[model samples]
Target: MNKATLASALGSPSAFGQSQFAFMRGNAFEARVKADGGAELLRLVHERLDPEAPPPKGGAVPDLGASGPEGRTARTALALREATGTGGWTLLDHPLLALDVAGSPAFLEPDAVVVHPDGSWTVVEIKSFPMLDGSADAAKVGAAARQSAVYVLALEQVAAHVDPAPRVRHTVLLVCPKDFSNLPTASAVDVRKQRSVTRRQLERLTRIEEIADSLPEGTCFAPDLPPDRLTAAVESVPATYAPECLSACELAFHCRDRARAQDAVTSLGRSLRAELGGLTTVGSVLAAARGESGDPDDPAVAALRRAAALRSEALGGVAAPRAAAEAVPCP
Candidate 1:
């Protein structure tokens, strides 16, 4: 069975799963865009990303099909090398590329990889999000840019294998529906910053060997393990919980529950944690606000005390100190 099935069996929410409605909609939109041999897709890339470059003239979509991800990745690398030598427009649909992340290969599949006439490649990311009045949601666009950055990083690995390494453009093409219509519109998003950040983070990640060494001997993460044993095994490993994990991690809810149970101030949010100084727990922060136990000289504690006093005064000065402390917002 796949990882998702194992996760479901283990009572862990599927992080990679999406709603059927959204999944179907996105798939249909992408299929429509890529119909007609991706003619519209090429036009958008030419018009939006590289207008100066000649329009994709009779591009070829080489068949790079293979049974598994590894074989497909190899085929994609071979196609890229050939495309570079030809110096002609070539579009690779759903091509697989692999990047070494934390000493492991992370395979990525971009919507399309367009090999330009200049031997440079562009990563294309297609989304169903509409561009209303030439403006799309900034947050969604940012997410697409980050995703494209990952594809770019993976492409660079392939480029390294080619003689006279071809360039992987930092600017990617983001294609979306135009103004609530199914017609495609494209925008060039520069992902230099995102690419650098992702590269650095991936490079700096702790190796799996170190983590395994730290775990107790005979520990296993098999999904079929009993609930109690699984919970204990999970708890044995350390986790750095933050608000961002909610959208990205399957175990985020579990970690948040643990944090809340332990009174960790970080359970609320990272921003709140930063302002709490030495007060790392919700209970400690509340105690400091109530002036029960904290270094009065610390700016964070002093500010909390001042804010608590002002809040009490605003409430007609009738609120008891403990009650006023409890009313202080942790957000």
Candidate 2:
């Protein structure tokens, strides 16, 4: 895998991993995908493969770095231009396949890898942080480390085929901005903590790999749609979860519309919980209100019993005058 391509692959996976299942609804996502391009006769096949969505790309992205993202590439290119003078970093972009924690594919693509004359490789994950602080954002640093770990995994599988049997070590170079709000920094990156953070990620991901290998197919924690299905929907696309929704899910709008028609008491467990207090679905709430008790200590049962007592006092054949003390609002 080349640098740019590796970036695309590793880039989106981190954010998209949790949403895999939601994205599996083929028809909707497919429509969303193909809506980008034209000639959509059967194109919107974002989820599963049914001749609706197009095939997935061989890999993710590869050109983002070259475009001077955050000035990382420009700086790296300049450094290479100076270091090699006539030549650039041997591997400007490349992908490595290290097993993910689940033994599924965890990949890495570096902006550049400094291949030494001695055949040792120093991996660089360029950053855009400014040089002034000599510090890195803890969250951003963690993400880079995790991303780099995937590359470390990928290279283990595919590096030997290259010309040099480069001694691969987990090295990351973070390129940052000279100033926070200023032009992007393509050049300077802090590497002091790269190895420490990266080591932890490797350990974590490998555990994931072990667990994945242990499970059978069709198990939880596996991709909602198989890799093949993902590939199928590359160009065709599908209906998105939903644009105006909270999670950006394709069905979010639909669910919201459905929710508006019913009160929480008549809806799901959570809704009842919200409306009637904890564990207060319609059945349980009604049961309590009727004084048909379950466990006396149960809050639901108690609340219902209390309401029943109040109603009986007020609605008995001869109603007593209102309790001059206070008023009870109608539920």
Clashes (candidate 1): 0
lDDT of 2 by residue, 1-331 (tens): 2322322332232122345554454334333322322112111111211223233232122232443232543444343333332222233343222344434443334644543333344455545434465566777676776666555544444445444444555554444444554322322333436545655665665354454455555443223445444333321222222223433333343333334443324234343344355533344455555545367676555655665666656677243322211122134
Candidate 2 lands at a TM-score of 0.33
Give the per-residue lDDT digits (tens) of candidate 1, residues 1-331: 2445444545766676678998898999899888877888888888887788788766889999998999999999998988885756788999999999878788899999998888899999999999998889999999999999999999998898888999999999998999978888888999999999999999899887888899999887787889878778787789867888887777777777788888898887888788887889878887888889899998878878888888899889998877777654433
lDDT of 2: 0.41
Q: lDDT: which candidate is best?
A: 1
Model 2 collision count: 63
Q: What lDDT would each prediction earn against the true structure?
A: 0.85, 0.41
lDDT for residue 135 in candidate 2, whole number 0-100: 64
Q: Assess every candidate by TM-score.
A: 0.93, 0.33
